[model samples]
Target: MAPTFYHRWPEPVTEKSGSMVQSQCWGWKCLSFGLILVVLGLLVPLIIFAVRANSKACKEGLLAEQECRTVTRLLELQLAQTRQDLVGAMGEAATCNQTVVNLSTSLEMEKARGLEHLTRREELQREVEKLKEKLQKASEEAERLRKEKEAWSKQGETSFGSSSKLLSPLMVPVCLFLGLTALLA
Candidate 1:
C-alpha cells in the first residue's frame, strides 16, 4: 500500500507486511526518543547556565543598589550639614549687618554732638575776646584819670585850704568808684 498522511501521524501498516512495519515503527520510535533525549540533555544544561547567570546578575544588582542607597544617604547627610552651615553663616552676616548699622548711627550722633560742641566753643571764645577788650579799655581810662587827678591836686594845693578839702573829697569818691569798676572788669 501507498503511504498516506493521517492527521500528520503515520498510520500503523496492515498485516501485508506485518513484521517489517513493526520493526520500522520500533526503529522510528527509538530514533525519536533518542532525539528528544539529546535535545533535552543540551537544553537542561543551557537552562541551568542561564539560571546561574541570572542569579549572579541579580545578586550583583542588589549589591549595587545597596551601595547606591548608602551613597544617597551620605549625600543627604552632607546636604543637611551644608544647609545648617549656610543658615549659620547667614545669621552671622545678619548680625554683622546690624552691628554696622548701629555703629553708623552712633557715629552720626557723635558727629552731631561734636558740631554742637564746636559751635559752643566758638561762642565762648567770642565772649572771652569781648571781655578782654572791655578790660583793656577800662585799664586805659583808669591811667588817664589818675594823671588828671595828680595835675589837679598839684594846682589846688597852692590855692585856699577850704577849696582843696572839698576837691579832695570829690576826687576820693570818683577814684573809689573807678577802682571798683576796674576790679569788676
Candidate 2:
C-alpha cells in the first residue's frame, strides 16, 4: 500500500515474476563468475611469463645489476661496522660495571675500617657514581647498535630475495643457508 525500504528490486512486469527474478539473478552470477575466471586465466599466464622473462634477462647480462651489487656490498660493510660497534659498547659496559663493583666494595671497606680521611670515602663514592653512569650509557649504545644491526640484517634479507640473489651469489647468504639446510634435511 505504501512505499517501504524493501521495494528496491523491480516489481515483475508480468505474472511470471518468479521466472524473471530467477533469470536476472542467475544471469548476473554467471556473468560475474565468467569474468573472474577469464581475468584469472589471463593474469596467471602473464605473471608466469613475466617471472621467467625477468630471470632470463638476468641470466643474460651479468653487469646489468652492478649497481645492486655495489649497494649490497655497502650494506654488508655497514652491518659489519655496526656489529663491531655493538661489541665494543658491550665490552665497555662490562668494564664499567666491574669498576663500579670494585669502587663500591672499597667504599664499604673504607667505612668499616673507620678510615681517618672521609675524603677517601667520598672520592670512592663519586667514582662509583661516575662508573655507573658510564655503564648505563654504554648499555644504551649497545642496545641501539644491536637494533640497528637487526634492521640492516632484515633489510639485506628482503632486498636480496629477488633476482639479486641469482645475479650476485656472495651477498645472498640466505639462499645458500636455505640450500644447505635443504641438503642436510
In the range 1-185, model 1's lDDT, one tens digit per residue, is 99986676665667866988888899999999999999999999999988987897878998999999999999999999999999999999999999999999999999999999999899878766776676566666666766766776777765545565566567657756765674455
Error of 2 at 103 (Å): 0.4
**Which candidate comes out best when scored by lDDT?**
1
Any runs in candidate 1 off by more than 4 Å, and if so which?
1-65, 157-185
**Tell me, what's the RMSD of every candidate?**
10.1, 48.7
Superposed Cα RMSD, model 1:
10.1
Worst 10 residues of 2 by lDDT: 163-172
Could you say which candidate leads in TM-score?
1
**For each predicted model, how many residue pairs clash, with residues at least 3 apart or on different chains?**
0, 0
> Global lDDT of each model?
0.81, 0.74
| lDDT comparing candidate 1 with the true structure | 0.81
Candidate 2 C-alpha lDDT tens digits along 44-129: 99999888877967656655578788999999999999999999999999999999999999999988677656776787677667
Query: In angstroms, how far off is 149's CA in candidate 1?
Result: 2.4
Return the lDDT, model 2, position 181.
58
